[model samples]
Target: MFEPHGPKRLSDIVTGDETWFLFFIIPPKRLNRMWVDGQGDRHVVLRPGFQSRKTMFTVFFNYSGPLVVDILPQDTTMTATYYVQSVLSQVKSVINEQRQKVSTSRTLYLHDIAGPHKARATTQSLWELGIQVLPHPAYSPRLGTM
Candidate 1:
């Protein structure tokens, strides 16, 4: 469908996703070096057994570059309501402001089949914003078996 438009079609496509950001990262042993008087002064670095503190961030980008980056609010999970009201809304405004030349109605959105991305609220919101969602194929393990 986009063969005629080529690069222009690619430029109109926007993709978004969420990822966790660790509050603390353990440095590699090579980078954890320190000056010591002797071998006795060396200490063992114990890796944490428990999960570290982390925050989720939603990022939206197009062919040009990033359009929006939003941190999830503290103590809240990413739900359909939040996806529509927070993430998508911010992306909409940023696209309008930074990419004024691109028509919002022709903008194609791409994202994985996450629960929030497939939710009714998110679909309605995208429709209201005049952004078209590109259909993502669902992975089927059964098909691979054959």
Candidate 2:
């Protein structure tokens, strides 16, 4: 659908995704080198078995650069209500501010077919913000190739 419009349409397109980030990263064994005086004095490095502390962040970006990077609150599960009130609200403000030079009347959003992204609340919020979502296929043949 977007093949013919070219650069102007591409520039108005914004895509986003959420990812979990580890708060602590273990150093690689190569970087753990120690200058020990004796050959038998090398200490053992233990690796933790438990899951590391992590934070979830939702990031939005366009052709220009990143527009929003919102950290999900600790212990909070992402839901349609939260997505609309928190993330999309910030997106609306940032889009208005960053895309002021270009017209935002037809800003297009592209995201995966996640539950929250396809929720009714999210759709309503996007419409209220004057942003349109590009249709995403639930299944793609090329998915396995990647």
lDDT of 1 by residue, 15-40 (tens): 98999988865656765576778656
Q: Give lDDT tens digits, candidate 2, residues 1-146.
A: 45785544677888999999987666667765767885578776575343478899999998888989999999999899998999888888888888687655679889998899999999887887777788876697989899
Score each candidate by Cα lDDT.
0.85, 0.83
- The 10 consecutive residues of candidate 1 with the worst lDDT sum are 43-52
**What TM-score would each prediction reach against the true structure?**
0.73, 0.73
Clashes of 2: 0
Candidate no. 1 TM-score: 0.73
